[model samples]
Target chain A: MSMTMTQKILADHAGLKEVSAGQLIEAKLDVVMANDITGPMALPIFKQMADHVFDKDKVVLVPDHFTPNKDMKSAENSKAIREFSREQCLTHYMEQGKCGVEHAILPEQGIVVAGECIIGADSHTCTYGALGAFSTGVGTTDIATGMATGELWFKVPSAIKFVLKGELQPYVSGKDVILHIIGRIGVDGALYKSMEFTGDGVASLTMDDRFTICNMAIEAGAKNGIFPVDEITREYMQKHSKKVYKEYQADEDAEYDEVIEIDLSKITPTVAFPHLPGNAHTMEEINESEKIYIDQVVIGSCTNGRLSDLRKAAQILKGKKVADTVRVMVIPATQKIFVECIREGLAEIFVEAGCAFNTPSCGPCMGGHMGVMAKGEKCVSTTNRNFVGRMGDTEALIYLASPEVAAASAIAGYIADPRKAGN
Target chain B: MKAKGTVLKYGDNVDTDVIIPARYLNSFDAKELASHAMVDIDPTFTQRLKPGDIMVAGKNFGCGSSREHAPLALKTAGVSCVIAQSFARIFYRNSLNIGFAILECPEAAKDIDEGDQVEVDFDAGVIKNLTKDKKYQAQPFPEFLQKMIQANGLVNYVNQKREGKL
Candidate 1:
């Protein structure tokens, strides 16, 4: 049977000759992950099922969501997971000071690699598919099961093929590409399906761009988003990971539910308006309407907090001061990336530009801390989701955009096109 | 298996954030979580929600975040089951893992109105709207899922398997 990349990987892990869409199979997991919030929730269930995890090395715990102890409650929750990790002697537990967002650090630390089946207790776990892994999010109960027995059930997903052509225009990054796709397909466009990206245009995207694209696959309700392993992927793996990785390619006859063609060059710097990621509009469309103002700008998150994302923001913010009316917060995804930003003087640029450069945390992205909005406020953020009440009061609004747009908006106090904004 | 309840309807993309906002996720107590369930969308959800109530919504229900707290919140708040036109992938698995009942039926989801009395027959894959005097068909759970529900949840099922009682 001819199988797609996701199917081939699942079949190999399941010890099956072949599998098809919607077929249920129990497959071995290469990695099982949870963060502070879900980690503590799964402990009691994990204890009830088994005294020890199936494999300590295979289990990873990162305290990120409300880290730096947002409050007394978050502090206690962090302690619970900390103690649990120490008790289990888990191989991949990251302490608060040393940790980053789960999705960002996992790939950066070489914990998740190609041709692996990984599950995390966070929706953005699909981010690893950028590295050619079959990864998806699960609940606390699923995490408990995975910890107790390094295996979990899966329903193989049918796929949607996105064929890309042409190179992206300047100021357009992977965030725009994904936001454009999500807007076109609506939030649930790829529900219960795998989004497989291919075409020569793939070669033009940096690894950071691919990671950004795959990170928000969940925003479109995709089970996962994957790219075929290429020279760029191999190079990234060689730099970060010591684990030998395997590569899988879809057969020529691989069945796809639908095929969508995307012209990367035509994708302008895009933004998803209030409420839904599917409410996407390009800068041209947005500029033609009444100018939308904002009270705050957040230029970081797992979605666009990588090195390239930071560089883009810093380049635009170097000499420009943010609007006196808007508050700008820039957060790196991990501790390592944070230090690298400072070393590269991007930190200096942000501070001199009157922006608050924060430590690595998912803060403000999920409205946990750092920059929660007030009632009747508006924000342009580089995070993935902009659901109602995501950042603060239900009345407040969120506009999802690329780092370039976010940085520019911080200066203009309204959503602005980066290319046209004064430097 | 069967469930009966009055419906509480919502529109499309009823996301996890609104179902159980991230601000309240610091607590693991099911009751504490339940107290705030759907508060973002309806500030009076906890007060209005009665035991054995059914929550109904339009397309792409539970669209954001993989926080199982969404399902746990609804289940603990006495939501007997949820009927939606469709559900996000992670939310679907999370519901079943916790033994929460959910059905996908476009006709019922579209026709069912707030405060309508609804009855679901899981074995027969039928949803009866008593208030509307209508019946709609939904896909039944597969054998494994049916067994998991019978065991009360995945935790119990795993325990039974470990003891060779499966």
Candidate 2:
């Protein structure tokens, strides 16, 4: 009978008293997002239906994935989005490298807020749930509908409480926690609910760690993943949000469909194997005595390519050259983060380390033009998901790991341990 | 709601990438999308599917991706309704917004088969697999959703409300 966090957020946003899971509700959207991959296709459909742009304030068009135009198709698509943003007089259209990723840059730019519903045409839109917003990704067509009408309808989802305790191990991080959670839940668990990650462990996570967890919520089949606001969230708000706002939390007795407890301390540095996040293996499971072949090592995405992620990768890669056989690709999540890395000389280290540092884009993460994998190539990536051919040729393999794992693997030319490589 | 269809059946984890693959990502037309719908996962889905065949699938149906085209492709493929045990968040929201019926029936797929003749009453939230004498619960549509479904789609629903025709 009690309103869960998502229900509460929806109620308040929709101007209602309360709502329940599976109950249809008309809610006001706090932010609606679309990326270059989806926006160019969906925006034209929106134009076909309506004569004018919808409310520009709520719309955010981000040019990521393929930025600065990778090819003719990508170039034209980015240009089309730019033209649409101009025609609509939208203020939130982030150009190449200006916004690292729709999922990353928006929150840092203060577009994502606590206790609201956000939609993006990019699946990674679920990443915003880290801030306690009920965000999810939709198709371009649905975005077109949202653009025409300022309102969208949602059936409140059953919430799954992921209660965490203990602490992350030295080499382990939030990415490990999520991978472990996924390992426990299996590929199909949390199929249709929001995974609200809470408990003592949550409070200990820095914003970046929390982002890493929420960013992969989609892989678990959850609509969104969320963490309650805390001091770290408050600090992030201070730096990002121009206009400060109040925070909301779940009621202590709030009802949930299911609750899971995770002992963060028990988690280890994990790798999502051959084809899915659920196929997890702890470092001990890997035969480190033997070498693995890798064609690429990418340490970024909206998932783990934040400022902290870059710093972590830089720490591992500094003074070490990427393996002769490996091509290390480092992508910053946002222009601000990219600029900061340049200012700190971290970008220079990556370049000097035999790494190919690219401009801010979702590049290689989605295999959208930049750094796409060839058939049979093996890649260690900080990005989430390893669905077959998800990154490129079906024969290519993607290993999901933390930035530390990815960078170290790049240097060793295989799936190597950062600590061992550091030594 | 102005829905006319029998029914079809599918299994779980029916992802969007399966509905319309990235190979066809360049095409934007609903008709073009319809032709390729489920062609990846169910190679015969488009060819064998008849007009107005509602699809009933297992839990976590339509997971992955934010492409609204997944729903549009189904609609274009003549899928009248989608009765699933569960649906990923984005697909569910997008389906309702685009005037597609997505009912949560925890036991829907378990009770029905591929050739089942089905009838769904949006107001009642009930699915009748007329062939098997099986029935499933589809949570009745809320006021907002009922109106949208009745209007045939989001655009029409909004337009009707704006014109004071609802």
Candidate 3:
């Protein structure tokens, strides 16, 4: 069988002679990560079972989700995680501004790389797949095992090809592309397969764009999403990582279990409905729905909180203040991004437009802290996942859209198209 | 570490929230987690699971959250081993770190059913599903890993290391 770059990496590292689609193969693991929040509980379990401290080098810890705790409970949770990190002698524990978010920090620190199998105590661990590794998120127990034993099991999954052929239109960021894909393939469409993203349109995107696209692959229930290292990848790696990376590309004759072609040009700026990424809609289509009153409009997360996303939201919100009734919050994915937004004056633009920006944490992504909407309140968000009560009350509603839509919605205090405000 | 147990079947995408929901993230007690294992998905996984029942899941088992309560819940609930087609990354590692036998039988999930008496040989990297009378391949534990497993978990392993037996 023709093998794609990802397949080859998984197969070769799995210690098997050769692997085909849907074949079960277990591979050796190279890296493992956990954050302060998850690591606290997980380390105790690890301590209960294993006699050794975690291999200091193989483990990484970041305090990203709740950088600025709003209350004492969260503060205690953060404190526990810090104490656990110190006790375990974990070498890498990122601070608020030093490094931010588990996913971006690991890669930025050269901890995540190609041909590695990494298990993090976070769900978005699949973000590393963009660099050619087989990576996925898991519960806290799993991170403990990887750190303790340095191994993980994997059933070779069938590949689903997402072939993109057209360029994205103006104001349409990579987040929109993923939202469009989610719309086409509901939330659980790729439940047990690797969603391999390829095609000409992929060449047009940068590394950050690819990361944003792949970061949300798990939302579609994909085992992982990947784009082979290209010039764009090389450029990003050269600037950030000093280590060498082995990149993979799908073979020309590689066979995919299923193929879905997408014309990026055909996709309009879209939104995911109240409880799933799979439910997608264009602004025009959404205009027909009952008016959506948003209590909050957020623009950040592993999904859509980047310099580009911030810039776009700033562009749309510049000079136009958000409605008094709407509360807008932005969480930069990492410290670098927060720095960039400030450096480029996008931070000012957003703040000037009534959008409050927070540090690089997953504050509102889990609905735990930061901007939790009230019962029956509605929110438009850019982060992944809009499950019932995901970011607020169970009775609260959520609409997932690109940063542009979120910004526009903040101004109008209801779901409105950014294009309509084309002042 | 080697363990023998009965097979307990589960379907796909058994997430962490199902194992131990977000609401129960507080507290680090093992028994506390075990009591809530699979409460969200089955609400009976804990009560129904026998002391030596080994859990086997189809694919994407433990797919959400980094909650450590999952494996702790499974271990405390009396699951002996977990053999799955695939695991969400974190759960796989967590299971091992906590000393629960996680046998990587990528195909065993598809082959075995509920209530199959299985023998998991960590040193040999194979699972004998006695009920099905089939022996499925599993990744053998390396020498270092065997020591870690025998010690029961990471903390135990560290203790053993401190004793200079590692």
Find the candidate with the highest lDDT and give its number: 1
Tens digits of per-residue lDDT for model 2, A196-237: 988988877888898889888888987778888888887887
Candidate 1, B109: how far from true, in Å? 0.7
Against the reference, the lDDT scores of all candidates come to 0.93, 0.79, 0.75
Please identify model 2 stretches exceeding 4 Å from their true place.
A44-54, A288-292, B1-11, B34-57, B74-85, B100-144
Which candidate would rank higher by lDDT, 1 or 2?
1
- Per residue, candidate 1 scores C-alpha lDDT tens digits across A1-423 of 899999999999999999999998889999999998899999999998999999989999999999988999999988998888889899999886686989999999999999999999999999999999999999999999999999998999999999999999989999999999999888999999999999999999999999999999999999999999999999999999998799999998999999999999999999998899889999999899999999999988889999899999999998989999999999999889889998999999999999999988899998899999989999999999888999988989999999999999999989999999765
TM-score of chain B of 1: 0.96
Interface RMSD for each predicted structure = 0.7, 2.8, 4.5
Tens-digit per-residue lDDT, A47-156, candidate 3 = 65465544777777776765675556556767876776687777777777787877777776677777677777777888888776778776665566567766654556
DockQ of 2: 0.37
True-structure RMSD, every candidate: 0.9, 3.4, 6.2
**Candidate 2 chain A weakest ten by summed lDDT:** A44-53
User: Which candidate order results from sorting by DockQ in descending order?
Assistant: 1, 2, 3
**B1-166: candidate 2 lDDT, tens digit per residue:** 5353566678777777667765455545789989989874577988888888888898778777777778888989888888888887778767877777788888777787788888887777877877877777777766776677777667677667767898
Fnat scores for every prediction: 0.88, 0.42, 0.37
